[model samples]
Target: MIEPSPVKKEPIGKLISCVYRTQLKRMSRSLGEYGIGGGGQYSFLKAILMTPGTTQDQLTVKLKFDKATTARSVKQLEAAGYIKRSADPEDRRSHRLYPTPKAVEFQPVLQALLDESNARLTRDLTPEEEDQLIVLLQKLNLED
Candidate 1:
């Protein structure tokens, strides 16, 4: 009979992708109640809230999202009353983004939801482990 091969360790990219997909599912479910779409929509909203008058191009770069994605998220947010866009005076082609009053009022709730999501993600890890993971992830981020 032929002997079976030993199982190799999972690739780092596969593990990260799995975790990311799970996180997105959980976040999407929580954000649905607030009419926020899944897959980086909340991230865009948070950025706009934190920095008003930011242009789409700026967000595309800052958030590491494609220009098409930035445009779609901005459109959805505007339709949902979470943000507003105005033409830039110096650049007619560019539009600056601002959070609407609705989004401003909802900011605290959004933050609380994000906090809960993060807490759930790290529930299995000790404080030291979580800290170490964060450090490692930051190091990985530096590669980009």
Candidate 2:
């Protein structure tokens, strides 16, 4: 009897999606301790922390998030008291996102959680593999 072709491998997109789902689940669990319930808030917080004056439009493009998602998240973060928005000085209709004192305090904690998640996810990978994976992932992200 012929061996069933060793079971066809999953497509790259499916495999990457599985990895993303698992990572996000782990991140959510880790961030829960800090009152961050998933839904990509961690990313918003981190990006704002890194670039305090970033505009919502800038974030939408930088984060590759839809405008609606970005708007909703900005509202949610504001409600959570982690971010504050101000009208852009040059653009009458644009608003810039800034991290609150609370968000500043939470930055390190969020970073630690992210680092732990990354380590856990890559526990089986060698240093070289980890570097290569990150480079390849960035390449994919940068591709139009």
Judging by lDDT against the true structure, name the best candidate: 1
Deviation of model 2 at 128, angstroms:
1.3
**Which residue pairs show backbone clashes in model 2?**
none
Residue runs of model 1 more than 4 Å from their true location after superposition: 1-7, 141-144
Estimate, for each residue in 33-103, the C-alpha lDDT of model 1 and write its tens digit.
Answer: 88999868999999999999999999988988888999999999999999999999999999999999999
Count backbone clashes in candidate 2. Answer: 0
Q: Which window of ten consecutive residues has the lowest lDDT sum in model 1?
A: 1-10
TM-score of each: 0.90, 0.89
TM-score, model 2 to reference: 0.89
lDDT of 2 by residue, 1-144 (tens): 223467887887999989988887888788776677676778888999999999988888988888998888889889888999999889979988999999999888888888988899999988988898888887785545
Which residue runs of candidate 2 sit more than 4 Å off their true CA positions?
Answer: 1-7
Error of 2 at 141 (Å): 6.0
